[model samples]
Target chain A: MGIQNTLEGSNTEIPEIGALDVDKIKQDFPILQRKVYGKPLVFLDNAASTQKPLQVIETIQQYYTAENANIHRGVYYLSELATQKYEHSREIVRRFLNARSLKEIVFTYGTTDGINLVAHAFGRKFIKEGDEIIISEMEHHSNIVPWQILCEETGARLRVIPMNDNGELDLDQFRNLINSRTKLVAVVYVSNSLGTVNPIKEIIQSAHEHDIPVLVDGAQAVSHYRIDVQELGCDFFVFSGHKIFGPTGVGVLYAREEILETMNPFRGGGDMIKSVTFERTIYNDLPYRFEAGTPNIAGVIGLGTALEYVENIGYEWIGAHETEVLQYGMNVLSEIKQIRFIGTAQKKAGVISFVVDGVHPHDIGTFLDREGVAIRTGHHCTQPVMDHFNVPATSRASIAMYNKKEDFDALVRGLHKIIKVFS
Target chain B: MDELRELYQEIILDHNKNPKNFGELPDANHSSEGYNPLCGDRIKVFLKVKDGLVEDIKFTGSGCAISRASASVMTTLVKGKTVQEAEELFKRFHDLVTQSPQAEVNLEELDKLAVFAGVREFPSRIKCASLAWHTLIAALKEKQEPISTE
Candidate 1:
């Protein structure tokens, strides 16, 4: 029997909020019911990518089976239906982020693509030589590299906000870094490596004091909590679909409509232009101007279904369940005397990164895989975070809404077995 | 599975705990660095060759038990061998770690190095076992660029 069965049979109360039945919720993910190496699969690698539910899976299948057609500029019946579905997905994304209008939501390949677009389009138009772009030290490489490239191209300098030992960003130092020359503030809403949910509202308010625009990387935050772009007053926000139980190759870039209108196009192609002559080309409206070519139609529909599913479950229950699991995991793993927790910020999400005294993370990952427990062991695309911690890599276990206390139990068991072998 | 036991044998654990030639050779003439970027395992192999024979050899780095122990075992096997013999041994060792798990290995030829034959069962660790050997080869060729098993 699985850990869920064992826990349910015991006298312990499962501490669930509202209708957050984790056992019933786990039934939605078909992959979780399988066995790996004759043991039940315990997936803890949610930070890398979340597993798709049957709802999202069936949405994509239905799109391909009946509603497959190129969106926009089609005269046939199926084309109109496909266009409606694609636009409906955009509306869903706009509502999910609580943006001002559908014009503020632009579809892209993923978060990296969206960041690259802003770095190229906005940076080329407004930023000049001697300008500065501020980022944090704990940012993923995706958020750092594009700005570095933009700095290289525009002769702008990149400044970083340092982090404390507890993995929280030094907001005072961040305020010190902003000045007239600071063009924009690009920061992550929640760090994928450290699991630190940054104070983005305060950061945005601070930047606005200097009349500087801010771009929040919400790739790690959208799945953990609800986001209200209008309320945050950030100029731009970006997140990926795969990180939120949706399909890959689809993401949302929520830019203020006025700001998006001013930025130049990153890629120039068909459907993004109204009329193209040999001399000049007039661009399309707010969103289509940024989305150059044929977007991922089916993937967008899958994302809509995924967002609708999250809406039905509600963020309050999801957040409460995830917090409980995170606390339980920290308490269980703290029992290991040799384990050192890497990120101990009080305002953390479901991610827990730790390193054993004498064990390399790769070996720990291999041993855990044998026990049918999956965890990510590396820098997690945040090399600077690892460098700051003075470790090459770490073993990370991030929780999703579907995760339970039993998953942490299996992970702790696997870790104990690893310590035995290494000892 | 039993393959995990084969991969982490007693010999590997001993060598990992007390590695042989586990420091730098400041006076060495030839040296090269090898890095596995995936796991951040960096190794620098130093060699002192005189009259076509390996006069002295050492390595400096940090990695998993499999990699550190493989480097330790490699230094012991190729200490006094000739340059050509070392290259030939590298070929045999490479084949030993990369071949199918069911394939027959001549244990007498491999001698102490036979402990690494089980690495074939774990495909991801083949690069770990071969990192030191590749760095040694780069040292022999006097290549300036660091070898990376990406």
Candidate 2:
């Protein structure tokens, strides 16, 4: 009936799902059982937002029940416990991203908040009129609009790195765009719309040659592939915890220590200030400087648990499994007539975008959902990329480690129904 | 999957395939551009309003089926209606589209429009269905030239 139900012969064992227990993995997510029009749910919208696992959900509940108090200020037992766990979460994120220092990590709301932070703090301080901020045509609106806002405010110019027909970034255009006037290069590490894994390390290195800082939007990249901030050498890296099977409203902004110290604090409030008076306020150091309010305490703890879950699974093995699924999905979908796939870059995560002849994407999504399969059918938050590809929208099927061959089969079957209906 | 035919009605598919009034009105008296940055829906509403009446209405855009079909249904309903009557219809349509709790209307003429009532069940698609309605409202507001929703 579905991919997960049919994939039972694999020898590999998932942590709790048993021997190739794709069904067990599906069982861990409660929402999978949800009936949309009285049928099982087949969620293929991981690129938009991932469904939380049981461990991540239980950790959030356990946090509110066992440890719930104001962090950093209170000296009471609960507060101290909360503060320790909160800071420990920072350490966990630091380890997750392989950052050199815990002080480099600052918690924000999500990718949008993280980008705004860099814009407000970094753009306000260093970026001047006529300076250039380079970005890709394939970037999500979160990456594009913030830089536009920055440029509008500071009188800076925004430079775009164009994409080729394959939805891959034109590195030559990027190279040509990077002049001495370029102040920043903000690129999405893995495009949410195209699923193109950008050559960010090379992009960062090239920017560094001209002494410009790069901010990698790792919102889509973090869960798909392993990240080493030190290895990538990006100055500012941002990602949402929700994208990695954790809670929403909590994200990380990983900036190099020196670069972070150079920028001013985004918001001045209680935990972020060193000493406050009616007249003047001294700011706190490093990460605290950026984290202003009573941070999402439970959210931070839950994110910590999420990172732990990812680490336990081992990113390498997860990547391998997802690659297998991606390949299988691409191969299967390619065989379907009138199904034209977009974003055929050699290097990609588990994202497949396509448009079928004579069928609207919404019609396809509706038909698929009737059969308990869910997929995203829209511009996927990157209109400029869609414009580049000369299409208005596409149906996106993004997979995760839990997605097996049977899921691909189910999608193929759904597409077959869609084609028949359209014909 | 056969049940999906309920949502993607033949009328809607027909309209989406051969959209009504799908062209630019070069002699339009009122025009307005609408954009939904969330889903990247871009639409330009062109109205030939004269003597306080809508002589003709047209739209041009590339969006999901809900948006295109809704726009198609909207133009057909509003053509030849007075500006005042169209405005009232817009109010009624807005309430219907949003599935307002106090919605009170008969859907005899709004048959294709009634199909969009299912859009209310999907909150995300509500905007797609309403994009052209808002653009028409904008066109009514501008009443001359073209206004950008930037």
Candidate 3:
């Protein structure tokens, strides 16, 4: 509850607090400096994947140039150094989420991979026939499809928590949907498509009342806000590195130490097993049990640096700057008479989803692309949310810490150009 | 920028706004659906074919201006043509859109369909311009399975 208090600060200027210097932040990302379509690149597609900062890019380069060796099981000098750096990245992730122990942090490919791991290992072990799993209408396909596959495999029923017109989940309906047969509840911390920030603490607390575990898809949440897994009390939290300014093919899955211990090993291979016999195999300890293969060593190092970069900037400035930009974007976009916002949730992050009355989202996307303004257009991997809104697609502009007010101006100008073209 | 202007020509915009042969045909012998999964653009092409000649052609769906306009223009051009002629026209239109941006197009053969020649410059929108034509081919061949611009 106090976490919500931290996020609800007024938009008053605090010059002494060192307000986020977006121009300075933009310098860290080289891609932002490049031109697209002969115009300055205005990147608003942060929700899809964020651009890497110099720190993270250099971290990957340094890892490859210096400590390029296979981790774990090697006794040589470079191998020891590589293993130490890799595990140090794990500790970085552990601190990033404030998990109880290093054992609680497991590295995977990305958010999708982490969710699939839980669905397979935890679902096979705990979920049974006649059991029920609850998810929300706002979950991305990654969160929905894996559970659906799990339900099909285990003969469990998948129940959905409906949302209102504003894209906010109906907690009463959620409470009604859960019963004795309910095995687990999986939901998104921040909706990728809607930008709705669900009250995760209350959700986790409610699930705990029924003694049911909750898994939070934090793919869209981690980069924008500070995440303390211990404070949230969710059993499992998942996020992707690419969404948080890190390199792709690396992510973190934070599970409680006891819960991780209970679930079966996700994948069996060299690093995940202590000893393998012809007929019997003993799984390795908590974290390694989930990591089965030779991991993305350089990507992991890059992710560590990415997390450090965010920490150095501090969440307070990030949140405040994003809030100001989100307000500016909304205000500017609302000027267009044809604009109809899809996600009008009272509490939102840095996303604006809207559709023009007479124009298709794809057309809007192409027109904006010509102006060097990049925005996502489609169901955004949350097809169910699109179906709920009865729209084929919506144009989405997601903001980040590096986004400036001028970006919103360019976006509004782009929208005006699109409207004129369609008219 | 010139290519962008060519892609969204006034004719394409007019066709998108007032699609000539828009809606379902009640007495259609052949019908097929075209879908672009990337952007969820769906168009159902309904044709009234008799003696291998298309008596009437119509389409109903929702999509970008390029897709809707392409379907509208295609229905107008293919309405009194034989199945063979329609198939030939489909090949020409496909070539016109997919050809390299710098390639010289024989616009005399394409006629009104030449408006879509600008799609060559914006490679991603080429599928949007061709979805309806592909669906028309599927209908002409009596293929029951819906075609997709994957």
Candidate 4:
């Protein structure tokens, strides 16, 4: 109660606490060396979008500066060079996902685009009126709305697998939800609102048993963990590039080769067609048929460089570091009397969603911003999760490989100041 | 700190802590809901209109301090005033919060709602400050659908 921290009374200086080598990792990102409101930036909004390192940025710049040309069907040297770089990036993505072949990797705008493509191309071909598409209560709006549209368009029933109050999915209910009529099972790899690392591998296995294909929304999961599509046995895996320190406007969709052959093209354009007559047209091939029009060539190259950046710093090290930081943040923030976390699953990632007593999350977000601690404050595109918790929104601080213990300390300090002002 | 203090003034914080007329107006003629989909902040305004005057006004919802406080102060400021007077106040309040920095907003003109003048500094929160006022407009007209500050 003594020396209550108010808006005007507190200074925003964060004392530099020494860390061993995450500091070395942070040096790679140029935006990390930044000040907001004259305070050192404590960026905890990694769940929304990660800041790109210099490697990704420089690669993007190098592409535009030196090799800026259209790919596929150009006979010039520059066109061939750009095409090879673009193909090489696809090879990188194939290796990154451990897909069987480059034919499995198709670049899209982002995860949402990838999901929409599946909804159109796959759903139109396979799904019927009485068929069901199973999703979870913890899905982001991006995952839910597309299926809802597909259901409305095709008369397909959308079944939701319920979750407990702890934000963990009920696999029993999921097993019950699947029947002879269930066409697809799509679930998130990690809950963006609740940090719950879902058992998507098990979900995939259960769906595959019924001869159903599953799509894993790895948008939030790809940045933190190493994903192997072969090991996961998921039929389709989709993720965004910007979430994993890569360029925006680029993403990867990995499907089995045979499945790709069955699905029709999402778009009809120049690159996707082999032979076209006014009377008859034939689709080009596997990955190319899915990737229509001029793609984000520079973005693909930058994404390749970004994945290499993650590879150079192994996932084993990143995962361990994230666990340590998540635990440390939970410990420090739990000390406050008013703090109540929304997600406390048995297994969680670096994201922490909480509500403070008598204070709204938007207010918490504004106060924290003044202290230069960036955190996501909302339903996080998962309104159903917000409704399940019966709270309007949550103040979420999600961490990344570059985040350190001091970031949480800064956040704790900011929250204390906000609580004092409100109290 | 100076900008923060200007934005979170003592009046705004106090009203947020203890909002005025915050409940369901049991005998209300006009009602409307406001939603900010960006942050999921929601507010519902209820008014008992009588003889071209706002006899009573109340609100119930969850949002940031700026929004709740704005709604609270708005109820207090517009109660017992004529519908036309309240509409005029709404115009002044909107101008006070959304006016460009280069253009001067006369404080004495806004009276109680002048604290929201700080809101113009933050473009994102301008919608937050103006949500209740927009909802109040909808309530005045008895709009059936919810008003969204997208």
Tell me each candidate's TM-score: 0.94, 0.90, 0.95, 0.95
Give the worst 10-residue stretch by lDDT in candidate 3 chain B: B141-150
Interface RMSD of each: 1.1, 2.3, 0.8, 0.8
Q: For model 2, what is the error of residue A421's alpha carbon versus the real structure, in angstroms, after optimal superposition?
A: 2.6
Worst 10 residues of 3 chain A by lDDT: A7-16
DockQ of each: 0.62, 0.46, 0.74, 0.77
Worst 10 residues of 1 chain A by lDDT: A6-15
Candidate 3, residue A118: how far the Cα is off, in Å:
0.6
Which has the higher DockQ value, candidate number 1 or candidate number 2? 1
lDDT of 4 by residue, A256-349 (tens): 8999899978998889999999999999888999988999999998898888888778788899999999999999999998999999999999
By TM-score, how accurate is candidate 2? 0.90
Going through the candidates in order, what is chain B's TM-score? 0.93, 0.86, 0.93, 0.92
* lDDT by residue (tens digit), candidate 1, A222-246: 8999999989999999999999999
**What C-alpha lDDT do the candidate models reach, one value each?**
0.89, 0.84, 0.89, 0.90
Off by over 4 Å in 3: A1-19, B143-150
Enumerate residue pairs that collide in model 3.
none
In order, the first chain's TM-score in every candidate is 0.95, 0.94, 0.95, 0.95
Off by over 4 Å in 2: A1-21, B1-3, B50-53, B88-92, B98-126, B145-150
